[model samples]
Target: MLFELIKLGVDAFSSWNSNRSEIKKIKLENKKELVQLDHELKVAKAQSQIRMAEQDQAQTYNLDMQTTIDMAKTYKDEFILIIFYIPMIMAFIGYQDEVLKAFKSLDLMPDWYILIIVLLAVSISGMRGLFKQALELIGSKFNLKGK
Candidate 1:
C-alpha cells in the first residue's frame, strides 16, 4: 500500500510540473507578443506625428505664397493706375494744342467747335470705364479673382 501511495504522489507531482512549465511558456510568449504590439503602436504614433508636421509645413508654405501673390497684385494695381493716367494726360495736352491752333486760325471760334473739343476731351477720359468693364468680363470668365 505504501509503495502505491508513493507512485501516485510522483505521478501527481510530474503532472503539476508539466502544467507549470506549459503555463510559463505560454506567459513568455504572451509577453513577447505584447512587447511587439507596443513597438508597433509607438511606430504608428511617430508616423502620425511626422505626417501632421509635414501638413503644417505645407500649409505655412501656401500661406506665404498667398501673401506674395497679394503683394504682387497690389503692385500691379498701382502700375495699372499709373498706366491709365498717362493716356488721359496725353489727351489733355493734345486738346490744349488743338485749342491753341483753332484760336490762331480764326478771329472768333464758333461755339460748336468749342463744344466738340470739350466733348472729345470728356470722351477720352471716360473711355477708361469701357476698358474696366471689358477687363471685368475677362476676369470673370477666367476665374481670376486673384485670391
Candidate 2:
C-alpha cells in the first residue's frame, strides 16, 4: 500500500513535468485542491498507524492474560495433587513400626533392610511432590511469582 502511494506521487510528478506541450502546469485553484488532498492523505495515514498500534497492543495484552490463566490452572492442579500426597506419606510414617514387623515376619532378608526398601518406595512415590510444594510455598512467601 505504501509502495502504491509512492508510485502515485512519482506518476503525478512525472506526468505534470514531462516534455509534452499539451500538458500544462497546474493552475492556482488546482494547486490548492492538490495540497488539501495531500494533507488529507497524511492525516489518513497517521490514523491508520494509530489504529494498527492499538490493535497490536490489545493482541499482546490478550495473549499475556491467556498465558497467566493457563499457569494458574496448572498451579491449582499441582496444589490438589500435593493435598493428596501429604496425607498418604503421613499415613505411611504413622504405621512405620507395624509395617516393619509385618515385613520382618514375611521377609527372607533382615528387617532393617526391608524397612529401608519400604521407606525408599514411599519417599520416591511422594517426596518429590513434597519438595515441590515446599519450594512453591517458600517462593509464594518471598513474592517470587513467576511470569
Candidate 3:
C-alpha cells in the first residue's frame, strides 16, 4: 500500500511539472505574438505619417510655385508693355517707315510662330477672358484664369 501511494504521488508531481512547462511555453508564444503585433502597429503608424508628410510637402510645393508665378506676373506684364510701347515711341519720333517695315517682316515668320507669338501676347496682357469669350471651343480646353 505504501508503494502504491508513493507511485501515485510521483505521478501527480510529474503531471504538475509537465503542466507548468506547457504554461510557460504558451506564455512565451503569446508574448512573442503580442510583440510582433505591437511592431506592426508602429510600422503602420509610421507609414501613415510618412504619407501625410509627403502630401503636405506636395501641397507646400504647389503653393510656393503659385506664389512665385503670381509675383512674376507684374514684371512679365510690364516687360511686355514696354516692348509694345517701343514701336509706338519710335513711330512718334519719325521712324514710322522702319516700324512698318519691321511689322511687315514679321509676316515672313511661319504661321505657327505667329500664332504662338499672338497667344503669348494675349496671355501676357491678361486678355484671356476676352479671348476665351471670343473662341468658345479653344476656351473650353484653355485653363487660363485672368485676374
For candidate 1, report its TM-score: 0.49
> Runs in model 1 with CA error above 4 Å?
75-147
Leading candidate by TM-score = 1
RMSD values for the candidates in order, in angstroms, are 19.9, 18.9, 12.8
lDDT of 3 at 143: 48
Residue 48 in model 2: shift from native, Å? 0.6
Better structure of 1 and 2 per TM-score: 1
Worst lDDT 10-window in candidate 3: 138-147
- Model 1 scores a C-alpha lDDT of 0.70
lDDT of 1 by residue, 98-117 (tens): 55565577537787986676
Could you tell me how far off, in angstroms, the CA of residue 66 lies in candidate 3 after the best superposition? 2.7
Candidate 3, 1-147: lDDT as tens digits = 999999999999999999999999999999999999999999999999999988966765665556457746468767878888999999999999999999899878899998898788876555655554567655555844441
| Cα misplacement distance, residue 81 of candidate 1 (Å) | 20
Error of 3 at 4 (Å): 1.5
lDDT of 3 at 87: 92
Give the Å shift of residue 96 in candidate 2.
39
Cand. 3 TM to true fold: 0.46
